[model samples]
Target: MSNRDYSMAFMDGGLGDKAKARYRKRRKALAKTVGMPYVIYGLDQGPGGGNPWDSHVPVIYQDPELLYLTGVNQLNTALLVDPITGADILFLAPHDAKKEFWEGKQLGVGTKAIEKLSKEITGFKDIRYIDDLNEAILEVLKASKKRSIGTFWHEATQGKKRVAQDSNYRFKKQLERLLAKERPSTKVVNIAPQAWDQRLVLDKEDIEDMREANHLTGYCFQDVLVAKKSLKTETDVAGYLNGQLQMRSPFGQSFPSIVAGGKNACVLHYTKNNDPLPKKGLLLLDFGLRWNHMHADISRTIPVSGIYSPLQRVLMDIVLKTQKAVQKATKPGATLDSLNTLAWDTLNGLLEKKVLAKGGLAKLEYETAPHRIGHLIGYQVHEGDPFRNYNDVALKPGMVISNEPGLYGYFELTINRHRYKEWIGIRIEDDLLITGRGCENLSIDIPKTPDEIELLMAALV
Candidate 1:
């Protein structure tokens, strides 16, 4: 199916309609606020090719890759407003031939996909030739009589952190040049508004995509569980999981797959994916996917063997209790502050006497806390907007979030030597969907209960 059909079908009927309605409302609101004769643009879903492996393969399906490149292909899907009334044009980058052969075929500027896009129904103004960009801007400017030209200037590029920082990237330079060139007379509005205390509530499409991603993650986790006992290296497991993501669905591994075992698992964000497999103890997997560009963050810490040792159990209990407490506390109006309060209290309640003796909650430092219980998960893994550090933003319905609370303490005797002697850590994470009443565990199928986890590991044995 085409991307549009796939997106539409994925968004269930009612929800899909709601999304369309919202898009219309957003556009109208923009028009009312900003007026017309303006331009609004957003980052495209980077380089959509046939397969993820093509990224590594030197030569494979080169045609499909080139066919999808849309440079500055502004659909003007959103309202580009100015103070004056003027014509509406969806600014798009026309297909370039030479670039297409060198790169890939040009998917006809907004021509083929504009109808699928939930934007204002209007014909597109193709700016295929970079040479025509100046003329287009001048045309708009002249029509507006240069009376404070306006276009949405979105500086926030999702997942382009590395590219944005690099001063030499072509896209970055072009955008920069546009801003510098237009600043003289035109008014450029930073379209992406930031809310300090808000958490992102999922829209219908967001929920559908996240649900699909969680489904894939749950399956991949099961595969890992079955493969754990037999595996000799962490890299093997990571590759297998990644292979599943690319082969099975439109989804791809959201971030680098982390397959740390034993002591290595304790190190959060361990992406080496090359650690030696452990014979016994925990294999903490804090990985998920970027399904259809949405995120599904999941972490499951399982015993490599079918059973956990007394020490591992103690650590697991602490982390599990903390996770359960946070899950229970997660409801509408529960702030991060309240969630953190619950996490600390639960951890304190579960801490072994030995751990408390060295330094109870009061004595422990920030490293012990290591990571927050959850964050807003969406287009970006740790999505934008809806500030997390505070608790003012109440959890709202349809908002997807991660309820991953973790505690990390190192084994090496060098960093803060007293708190943890053996250097152990535990983290239990799951994706949750906030609803009208409470929350729904999206990653419910993934084994988490002590018995269920043990049963899963037994299968591997």
Candidate 2:
């Protein structure tokens, strides 16, 4: 089946219609705000060099903004939106029979089958071959009264120097260079902020996609927990979880799976999953599944043994309590800063009560909770906006964020030198959908509490 047909079938009747309506509203809103002619470019090709891991493989990803507007995930596609008329034109690369012979067939432009399918799926009336992009852009800019063009532009880094890999940054620069030599009077403007603002809020279709993604992620977690006793290495557990996700969802992982075992958990963002599982240490699993371009970010740490030791249980309880408090305070009008303050207060209050020791409280707070409480979860795993440190933006309804609070006892850190001698790390994360009254835990089905985790692990033995 074609990409459009596959997406339509995946979303089905009302859901598909809702997505189309969302795209229409978004386009109209953009047209009203940025009152100028604009073009959005998708990824030209896959990332990496001509090496085996790079361009030669079939690993193309569409630009998120372009995908949001056109509902087309295929590479080498572009979208032009007329701000004054609110009309959309989709440009697709011409079909290359030779390339198709080596690779698979793609949705070719100018064909009756593709034209009908594109209109039905993307809701755009005008579709043309990408070869006409230069003429189309010039005509649109000339017709505009202001002679202005708007597109996204942001700097990208490759090693030391700023490099343009597959981003619109390079494309925008090339377009500017072309216009300078051709239409010297016309100017290019950045509309990324305006475009990103529209993507901040979650629509009904987006919420449904996230819900299903989290559901599948929770099941994968359960499968790994059930086989914890049989698992010997970190890679074994990571492979099991990834295998489950692939079997259930069409998309791959949101990011590399962090399957850190024992002391390795203290190191944040550990992606190397080759360490041996400690017979009596904690296992930290930080990973998420992506489905239909939406993502679910989740993390959970459990005992490698059937049950947590007394010290591990205490630390896990504190982290879980902090996470729950953050979730409870995540209604509308709450800021991430406020929630983080609450987390700090909860952790500090435990220290004040002499939970750990007298002087080590400050050291523990600094080392254990080094990272922020959570981040906004969406198309990107760390979806930017409103969830950054000290950002006072109020949480509104239809915003999905992650509620993750962790406590790590690093071996080298002086904080873990005394009473907590054994290397230990504990984190509890849940994807939350902010509602009018409160937040719903999208990953509620996954086992988290000490008893729940112990029970699940006991069954594995």
Candidate 3:
């Protein structure tokens, strides 16, 4: 394992109190419509088969005392000024010492460490046995009265599914039965969609962590550009980028690394890294470094030979121009829909000009620009938010969005000959944080200019 202490690496930046206040106002307004806002988080079960404690899974199992403290502290902060009964709030966890020995050492619950970590201002009691859960749930349900009992439900589980031979869906059935019996009057809250949408907009601590990841991501891309000569294959570049990211404080990737070379670059969500780079073609790399679950997403296209060919330059210029326009309009008040529309218009205009100037094809129209110009990047690679149906959800400070503009043109095709097919495909992406005045380009060092990129790459051995 790398020596970098990711957890202790303090991020100097944060969302600030102003952003927190804004979130408070927004959340309060939301709470009025959906009652007081007390949420129960069921700790994730640890991974089996002898894998090191996946930090992604609940660490509450490894150190019950610490996790309990975290839960208690969070609950206290939530109920700070509320008029709700102290006993109504509860932190539920399965306390099994035998299971702890099977996994790892467990910090005993109700210790001084737990108290300090939890910021013990709020009242809470921990139940050791699963048998006590039934009575505890009943008490909470009775106390809730008019206020609905709130709990988050997992929307989906990805990566490997286990099935039982005799009882199909036995795990889910048993879970539902347990929950149903625990509290008959309890109401489950569908925060999955809400969490997904809000994820794009970082909170105080989230921004602090993400900014560090963003800084690292930018610096690492510079390394990629500098060492392009050594990077002959997609896998080679992916490994290089992953090494840079992992060598830093954080030890994992935000999402699967994309290092598509040549025509493979056209594949939007490309993850296959085995392809070899053509001598003088384009390479589109989309990746991110994850820090404390917070991530910074970035994508860049570069010339394989350190200098773009005429056709490569043409496609790159158009994509760059589209991105520039999108960046210009990416203010705090703008929405993704408006940004996407602007990107389309900008790209289409450039395509039209290129066509008319060269007399390539007057009939072709650059209508839709592949994907969205900007998206929320945070906790989850694609952060969660609540505003799904609303197309005009105004942007705000503390929101980090991606400005990815792509141009895909194929050669020797019958449909649209104007689109360059042979040696083309460019996507330049960067993570930007919306500030009070306008925005801050977090991934600033990764070069976009042809001259800057060429000069930087030439310096490397």
Candidate 4:
């Protein structure tokens, strides 16, 4: 018998049709808003090369955009929508007998059984194989009076020179070519921007995923605290934390765990978790979990010895205070740019007052933590660059943003006639869901106070 239940080749993460219908419906709304007849979303299931890496399971990464629109994830899934009539079609891959015993089955166009299953899963009236994608596009174009093409491709160019960002952008280029030969004087409107605008705010279904993952993210931090006493290296902490997270959720880390010890913490975006735990500094842990297609990012800077020294306590307080101030200023109308400015002002105030650092210790540069404090989080750890286009977008209810403020610097200061020299990096990151009155700190449960962390880690056997 063929693979029963038709589990996806991936971890089969999705809310099915009902929860994701809002995203699919956006295609129709987007087409109308952009004045296009048809909108096409063609997503490729990667590593499609035949018989390569056989038997070795390579996990599939679902693009945040694709997953947001269609909850179900599999190989080569596409959706074609005709805004004129508010009709949509879901394209999928058919079953293969060869891999039935191992990789299970996928949704596709076929017999009544297959069609019903696809319809029930995707909530689309029409279900077809991906092979029909080209023909479907041509027909949608030909049938409509509008001489135009609709697809999401944020084309990056240096004056007509094609400069794509990543593999996804490269693949979108292929879809552009499919529609380029359609006819003369065809209008190409990029629906991608509109889709991104729609994605900025989370719907009810999305918020649930975000909240669950966030709660578990804090739990994962507590799990590490219990084992941190025995974990002597950064790599060990990362491995153990990630292992415990996956044991609970279907998917694992949003990105490689950033486990930095002591001065290594100053190296932002540090992923080389091989340093030994230092006897006199902080350990920065930055990690997130993927739950139900939504991601939650959290960062905590804690003392390596389960107790913060006077100097370490000041540094930790600086970061925690900066984060608290930003969180307080997060309102529905405040923009990311404004929030980030508030973060820096708060940090600088603390340092300028000799609360933690001296004048020479704080500098706004790539190595420091002031430039980029947070990013928009969702299906991916980073949805977009906060300093770029995402900077000025006003925080409305349902919009989620990250509030992380810290200082990363190298300095030597004399305290009580004792000279201290090290690279100090402390960052506290939490997801803030913009609410009507204010914003909710989704990761607030994660222990960050020196007293709380000391108590938690001190419990370790």
lDDT string for model 4 (363-442, tens) is: 33453334576778876677753224677877789888888887787655556766566678888889999999999988
lDDT of 1 by residue, 345-429 (tens): 6786666443455353322335446666677776567764323333445677776677877666542222244433444556778
lDDT values, one for every candidate: 0.56, 0.75, 0.58, 0.72
Estimate TM-scores for all models: 0.71, 0.87, 0.72, 0.89
What ranking emerges by TM-score with the best candidate at the front? 4, 2, 3, 1
> Could you give me the TM-score of model 1 versus the true structure?
0.71
* Candidate 4 or 2, higher lDDT: 2
Candidate number achieving the greatest lDDT relative to the actual structure: 2
Q: Identify the runs in model 3 with alpha carbons over 4 angstroms from their true place.
A: 1-34, 46-83, 87-134, 153-201, 361-367, 385-391, 411-423
Clash count for each candidate, listed in order shown:
9, 0, 10, 0
TM-score of 4: 0.89
Which residue pairs show collisions in model 3? 195-384, 196-384, 196-385, 197-384, 197-385, 198-384, 198-385, 199-384, 410-421, 411-421
Query: Which of the numbered candidates is closest to the native, going by highest TM-score?
Result: 4
